[model samples]
Target: MSSRTTDGRSAATTAALLAGPIVMTAGMAATPWESENEITAYQAALAASPDQTQIAAVLLFFGYALMGLAFLSVLRRAGGAPRALRIPAATLAFCGATMLPGLVVVDFYDLALIQSLPAEQAAAVGERAGDYGLQPVMQVPAVAGLLLGGILVMLCAWRSGLVGGWAPALVAAGLVASFAVFSGVTMVAGASCSVVAYGGIALRLRSARIPSSPPAARPATA
Candidate 1:
């Protein structure tokens, strides 16, 4: 594999590895969403159909955190590519940073929900009881940040011509998917981010691997 390809793969793999804890931290940080708003429509859905809601939430957070890290890694890889690199990288970074604050809010909301719950309901859920509460204002920004970030990253991939490759496409697809999945809640944004994050990881991998030679254009001498 070419050095560029090698570097990209190494970076992406590293990002994926790093994403593990970030996802976990995000999950650990996010328990409050369900706990705090168990009665809300968003949480109510989960309450009614926890298998989908709970599992999807866990996957969404884990994916979102990983994508954030992956996007960051891609930007770092592009550091030497061109001045335009900053646009997407910055967008990704900004979105990731913006989303970070919501973690605190989610936790607080969870705590609030748990405190407000009646003893019976709280006890029924047992371990998850501590998560109940009303959501905080920060939820808005978190969702917005992810949506905006996903859009920005999509533009970045397109502009950078990274979209020509599978990696870029994956990132772009994930970001868009997130927009759909995260429709009503911050989790939709989170899901979109995760898809993009994995895409970024794929790009990183591509950057590090040896790509096959592009087809040569035939001569126009005739």
Candidate 2:
């Protein structure tokens, strides 16, 4: 295996990594579900439990943001992760940071629109939303960053020997499978794996210490 290196530089970041996935999993588990119709799914979920839906959205917002922030610590210099690996991974994580958290506002918007507007009217508004040029502009990067960026980071971390292969596999499987699984049960399971993967890394970081800088050379003796 490649050389391993770690520096527990920030306890806060390590905590974030551990907590982020747990919160996200809670959000996923808390999320409501019903008919699979894309157009009406959010509306139905909101109807089933408005408070739960809102709470889940809030949790997701904070969770994804913390995950992004925690990822930054992975990119810290002299950490043994290769420059080539770290650079792209960090860039993707940054891209995710730029918009992933903001995307959660759409959940609130969906709730508001479904509650205040007539069903057909709200549906019409949603359909028209797709017609706008800005729709894809805002959504594409956000989803890609969260999904692709997260997966790549794990890949790089594993390849660079910052983590074991299981770390990447667990996270990647959870992430990819989460997209395929429609039920909340599977969602919770997927997020559970994420928690295990990231939280395990955090545990390691919690115990790690940075290498001390080189000491100053003594002056020549007379």
The TM-scores of all predictions, comma-separated, are: 0.48, 0.81
- Per-model tally of clashing residue pairs: 20, 0
Q: Count clashing residue pairs in model 2.
A: 0
RMSD, each candidate, Å? 8.7, 6.4
Residue-level lDDT tens digits of model 2 in 97-119 = 67888888887887888898988
Candidate 2 global lDDT = 0.73
Candidate 1 residues lying further than 4 Å off, grouped into runs, are 1-40, 49-59, 78-92, 97-137, 165-208, 211-222
Alpha-carbon lDDT of model 1 = 0.49
The Cα RMSD in angstroms, rounded to one decimal, for candidate 1 relative to the true structure is 8.7
Q: Compared with the true structure, what per-residue lDDT tens digits does model 1 show for residues 89-203?
A: 5664566554653363343343344456754454455445444554334455555555455455444544555444454455456556634554334443444344444455455
